[model samples]
Target chain A: MENVTKTLDAKGLGCPMPVVRTKKAIEELSAGEILEVVVTDRGSIADIPMWAKNTGHEYLELVEEGDVLKHYVRKGGKTTDKEETPVKTITNEEYLEIADKGPVTLIDVREPDEFAAGHAPGAKNIPLGQIDKRMDEIPEEGDVYIMCRSGGRAGMACDTLETFGRKNLIRVAPGMGDWNGPIE
Target chain B: MKVAIIASNGGLFDAYKVFNIATAAAATDGEVEIFFTFEGLNLIHKEGLKQLPMPEGKEHFAEGFANANVPSIEELVGMSQEMGVKFIACQMTMDVMGLKKEDFADGTEVGGAVTFLGYAKDADITLTF
Candidate 1:
């Protein structure tokens, strides 16, 4: 939470001006670093988020205390850089297309409950925590498509699988959050 | 607890009043729903909250809100949504006002008065604003 690298006191500023100033400050912000902007403008809560969305910044949140509003925005430019996994990856659409042609190995690294709730059809469930003991269940000779709720755990699973010298690992980027199709 | 709110006015304050109560009720782990009908449909228009301005003559209230840090109408609605408050857009009003289902916020249910009543029928508390 203390990741904020800079603070802009934008109090007493009126409409558009505060947001404009925020834009200026955001330009100077380093990628992935959070900027804590203190503003008195009530509209900033909505305006800041809108501006952030339009400008491609990550609107973390807004906190109101008494008569002051604090908006946290992170320079979204390189935020994905940190989350970029080293493993080979495919989108849900790509995975589906490949699966449609043949029996593809799709492993869901989400917890059992989440996998049970809804997941890609034919995807095997192996919780990220249990990947070690469940290594034998994972196919070693085929193109293994691993996924999770988002893409975080699947990346970790890729690292674990890599350690075992099982090189055919492809994580589903932005996983189930964007999964499109029928789920059993 | 189940909470139901009827928003009949379209003013900026109307949005604040409806969402304020809806969010407060929902904060307590209640199932809350706000029915937007008649003029209230203006509050749910895709860009309604942003388009709606402080009433004329109360324009100075903008400064006061700025000074007081009142959450914007959009913010309140967002908070209400995040707190699980359901928003229902009156389909009849939509047809009357030329508002298509896509004209309202995403996830806003397009329904008629009877549909809203169905949800409010068993509500523990129901209010009209």
Candidate 2:
């Protein structure tokens, strides 16, 4: 296609593969450059847009012909994990042990639907995307435990919060998705 | 994430769903293990794809997938294994189906419920289909 800088053929891949590959391909692109992802996975129709939105990229358009879909996305200046601060990490077992003792300011960084399904009691629902705006809701000074389905989103939240001057943040890796503790 | 999948159906669509999810999870940096039991073992059988049945009213799926070049269940199975998704066929199912370990593709593990539960225990996501 005209004006297409590069093409990634993720054809025949199912589910999240197209999106996962798109993330890597887009990173190799300079700001304002475009990456074309060709895939047969229909899920990418919705998944690609959501990924682009979450990663600060511009989803240009999707061209479809038969089973093939060509997705155009323009690279954003900064990455979703640009300010990555590899902070301290804790496991689900350790988090559970701490929670059993008393109250902990655990921030569940997953979406509302996931939170509503199951979450730690007394855990705040400040999703990773909304953390920047909801920073005030967190305690001005205290140890805050951040968690998500696994740990990726929580790590992102920690990075974003770190940029906002959060000092006492601990991440729960292998997060709620592996939690054997009580849920509210 | 560590993902544990229980595949208990042998239908074509069912096989596709399981393999699709498994391969996708593996591609997304998740460690995936699929435990095939009951009728699900048909998927790993050497001749299963040739005999795989289309679900009622969804027979067009085969034509559509073929026309679109979407990988078949067999292809998806290969892709899943290539992506490092562990494949475990049930020992009891093998006896019931009169199949031996050699009846499946190379590198498939044979295990029972205890093995599956051991892997599923620490899994972040457990799905049954």
| Root-mean-square deviation (CA) per prediction | 13.4, 16.5
lDDT string, candidate 1, A1-184, tens digits: 5757678998876554466467667765445668899988787777778767756788898889999999998877634233554689878788888888988888999889989999988899999899988999988897999998656678778888888888999988667866786687
Q: For candidate 1, what is the DockQ?
A: 0.02
iRMS per model, in Å, is 11.7, 4.3
Best by DockQ: 2
TM-score, predicted candidate 1 vs. hidden true structure? 0.44
- Candidate 2 docking class: incorrect
lDDT winner among the candidates? 2
lDDT of 1 at B20: 64
List A-chain TM-scores for all predictions.
0.58, 0.57
